[model samples]
Target: RAPEEPLHLVLPSDRRLLRIAHAVLEHPDDVRTLEEWADWAGLSPRTVTRLFRYETGSSFAQWRQQARLARALERLASGEAVASVADALGYASVSAFVAMFRRSFGLSPGRYFDTQAVIA
Candidate 1:
């Protein structure tokens, strides 16, 4: 995906999967494990994992990461501080958030914003 493009989350047809997706999208900072989420959704962990991959074309972990990244992009575009965004996203540290951002977009948060500014 392009650095400027928004991440698209697929909503599954299954009610259980849909519930989990909505929760993750609504609260990307939630750091619950797949098993915990499954329990909350009244699904077995194996079912959750299998259905997430089958219905969404991504694992639960990947979906949550994308959700978090999407929110991070929105906040950063609105001129939020890196540290603030990192904290709000439940990252262990600014550097950890930066690393994830860099891995995803191949640029640090500051450089990403700078590039975005230039493009705009």
Candidate 2:
């Protein structure tokens, strides 16, 4: 039989923060507060806040927003409509989503992909 593929590995230094990252990836659409994430991680809110920064070099809110942006990028790349991707990613409106996309990527979604096409 073929050998099994290796499982994803996390270094000891990163394991503590993996839980938070997994939670964010699993439910990017949910607008839970940091306190909720803290409670779910079985940590005090302040500890979660501090450790998240230490491990990820970003505040929990920023990390979560990045995760949401990553999800939006995937959907947009797959040719999903911008309005549908915006709503599914939990933006209040398409304009809000476009604003965030521009802020994060320095280009609107259409232009972002257009640039990628040129680079490719």
Candidate 3:
């Protein structure tokens, strides 16, 4: 079976949820927890988690990772080195970043352009 796609591509059905998501996007690398997001959105943590799944079809943590990955892709595409990108994105280490990137895209950041070239 094909891997399930990331849910950031899916729009949130609730306007309030969308606003919360936008706030999260403003600082995707800040390492904030769901509780923090809930406070920022003026909702309870449980409600925030439920709303994320209901409106965005992903858990809050999953959505955050997707947001961070999206930013990572942009930085990497602009010629940032993998280790530096990892640090800038608040990853514990470069290996962790590579692992997450591989899981998300099925290719390490180092090989992403190579794979694109082959596909083209």
- The 10 consecutive residues of candidate 3 with the worst lDDT sum are 1-10
Find the 10 residues in a row with the least total lDDT in model 2.
Answer: 3-12
The best candidate by TM-score is 1
Residue lDDT tens for model 3, 1-119: 54454635455767667877776677666777888767877889999889889877788888888888888878887888899889988888899999999998888987876766676
Off by over 4 Å in 1: 1-6
lDDT of 1 at 13: 81
Model 1 Cα lDDT, one tens digit per residue, 1-120:
445554787778899989988988787778899999999999999999999999989898888888899999999989899999999998999999999999888899999888878978
Instruction: Rank candidates, TM-score, best first.
Output: 1, 3, 2
Any runs in candidate 2 off by more than 4 Å, and if so which?
1-17
Clashing pairs for predicted structure model 1, backbone only? none
For model 2, how does the per-residue alpha-carbon lDDT over 93-114 read when each residue is reduced to its tens digit?
Answer: 9999999988777789999899
lDDT of 2 at 106: 79
Any residue pairs clashing in model 3, and if so which? Answer: none
Write down the lDDT of every candidate, Cα atoms only. Answer: 0.89, 0.76, 0.79
